[model samples]
Target chain A: MTLELVVTLIIAAAMFGTGIYGALSQTNLVMIMMGIELILAAALLNLVAFWRYLHPDAIEAQMFVLIVMTVMAVEMAVGFAVAITRFRSRGSVEMEEAQELKG
Target chain B: MSVQVIFLLAFGLAAVWFGIVVFRTHSMVRSALALLFSQTAVGAMFLVMQAEFLGVLQIMMMATEMSIMAIFMVMFMMDPGGLGEMDMKHQRKLSLWAGIIAFGGASGLALFGDWGPIATQIPDAGEQVRLLGIELLGRSMLIFESAGLTILTAMIAATSIAVQPPHRPKETPDKSKEPYQVHNHGGAA
Candidate 1:
């Protein structure tokens, strides 16, 4: 592997680590969502890196990335809507206290 | 190192730094912005990798997403202004160790893993984009349509769930005691 690709992969690894830290440690639901976003970004970096460096001619990776991006967007939308609903009903988005699933 | 490589290194480091800052900051809005900065740096790294379409989409999409995200932070988070100094985290030591272990595993694999052959002949940028378009509209069309339909269903579900009243009949009795009476500020403040 080239130095640049290796560096990109390392960056992905770092971003993943930070994201896991945030997602696990944060009690705030929004902060956890931000952590998940970082994880998705890291995944995207890996996909783009692999495609650019290893199989540039295949072209299918681009579509895969696009689909992944679409999925991310949809996930954020549903997630935040749930957050808003939770805030309106329970007046809180803290994951620790949101134990009751029926709401 | 070439100039491109230098730029890549600079952007990569910035991305990782901001990713760390996202969790370290006390303010929720600031944390979202830090995430935005980190994601933007990743987009720049994509540009450094010479993937223009993906890079541009990353910057634009993340800009929109994170902006809306800041609004949510202000709406839902307690003491988002950071005046209360309420700790927003839990399980700090355990999570730190988890993160460190994850990094160790990833780095070890990245360094030691046997990645197969690298393609030596990459098509020109324009040619690559053209092929990508054909690939998307051809073999990937069914996948795209399915994803589009799924997104449509999700949007309808989310809107219905979020826009409708929080409390309605058929909800469990204990929860509906004070119908529609929501405790403001997370029931903590």
Candidate 2:
């Protein structure tokens, strides 16, 4: 209900939008992964904003955000590891060329 | 507006600007750096919002992650400098429309949706942190332990996968190659 909360939420929304656009438009796998990271970041921002605004007394939301951060870190590491593996085998990380997964 | 609001507005604008540059730049390294700046600004916003521990954690984690990401960009990108003028993006128009629609929907929901009553009584930062610590080690101990284990597993898995495994009769390439002989000096760039 506060202006601070409203502004923060708006920023989070913009960030999520940008992430969607980047993930959809990028041809490179790394770029797409970056987009996904953005989306995760946006989600984090939203969670923290809501928690700080609506439920500051409750610690559950903080814990949830921490868990989300852990997931984001692990996901990025694994995603890039896969990208490197693909690059080593296929010589490029283009999503279009990953047709072997079309089964 | 209060000083806190002013700081939030400033940092938020910087974050949003850098976020836009993350996708706009052609150079992979530049994009990574831009994202880094954007994320750091977001962390600063958290600090201004009075979540000190979370804000610090956000900055530390993102800094480390983004540095590793930049190193990976240089290692794996075919043209890190973008001198080759590669098309880093595709379906631009559709992407723009999609982004706009998403923003509109989210903003609408955020502005008009009925969220439960905002808590009027809030504890101070010290009390909040104390309570958070207790909750983490007490009721949520299992979840925290599981997350820690998963993160450890992820780190080990990433390292094992990334490092080249020794295949046939371990020939040490680094040991075999002599350190610079300085023969017929190739002209410096």
Candidate 3:
């Protein structure tokens, strides 16, 4: 059981690392959102692992997971909407070219 | 190793691998699909952990969300197919260092941290779900309701932001022509 938790945590850490790379390095708005999605997934994985291994009886952990999932969904929605608006206005969603909002 | 551990490792590896793929791929569509697969693998991990409802919810939600993201990629990307061999990254060195540091720190914590005694007895799947439901509707009712409201607001905000504003016709004054004389309607009446 301890081994499983460690493995899961390590995996989640790897994912979190990859997401950090993606979110920080990606140029496009959609790609950035994808990175954010992965990060949130990592958080969810950690939450579930803890709930299962450490506090199996605590339903509140599950509730927290659901809330995180909702946050992920809402974030994606708002992100895509912003991407759409950016594309409509500038004809490109590249972050490098978004100097208009730099101030 | 128990069957559960094996399954957990498998799904965990799949999730990490596909998460890497999401960034390695140049094609926007491929990236989106890779993210979908990664999230699905995470869902499978949830199932391996015996959180049935969460696993199903993760899979279902990610499927729809990533499909929409794929569609958006096609619509918004200049080269969705990645045929141009364009590099889509910035601050590569910094990001690499950040990623490595984050992984090292998190893994070190996981490996060294003393997480108290592991719970050996988990409720059955059905009971777990029932208790989760009760918790959601009971003590967590406020949080649940807040989340719902936030989603509704996000939906509305997204729609409004995405919708094109009505174009009002520009009133071009015909300066070349004489202005029309407006007769007093009251005097005429």
- For model 1, the superposed segments whose C-alpha errors exceed 4 Å read A101-103, B80-84, B166-189
After the best TM-score superposition of candidate 1, give how far the Cα of residue B46 lies from its true spot, in angstroms: 0.9
Docking class of 1: medium
lDDT by residue for model 1 (B1-189), tens: 767679988998999999998887777678788888998999999888778888988999999899888888877765544545658889999989988888777877777777766555777667867887888779888998888888898888888878858456555557545554445786775
Best by TM-score: 3
lDDT of model 2, residue A68: 89
Q: lDDT tens string, model 1, A6-101? A: 777888888888889888999888888888888888889989888988888768887888888888888888898888788878889889888886
Summarize candidate 3's per-residue lDDT along B1-189 as a digit string, tens digits. Answer: 778889989999999999998888778788889999999999999998999999999999999999999889878875634545768899999999999998888988899989877778999899988998999899999999999999999999999999876683655878999754645669757
True contacts kept of each: 0.70, 0.57, 0.85
Docking class of 2: medium
For candidate 3, the TM-score of chain A alone relative to the native chain A: 0.96
- iRMSD, all candidates: 1.5, 1.6, 0.9
TM-score of chain A, model 1?
0.93
- Lowest lDDT sum, 10 consecutive residues, model 2 chain A, at A1-10
TM-score of each: 0.87, 0.88, 0.90
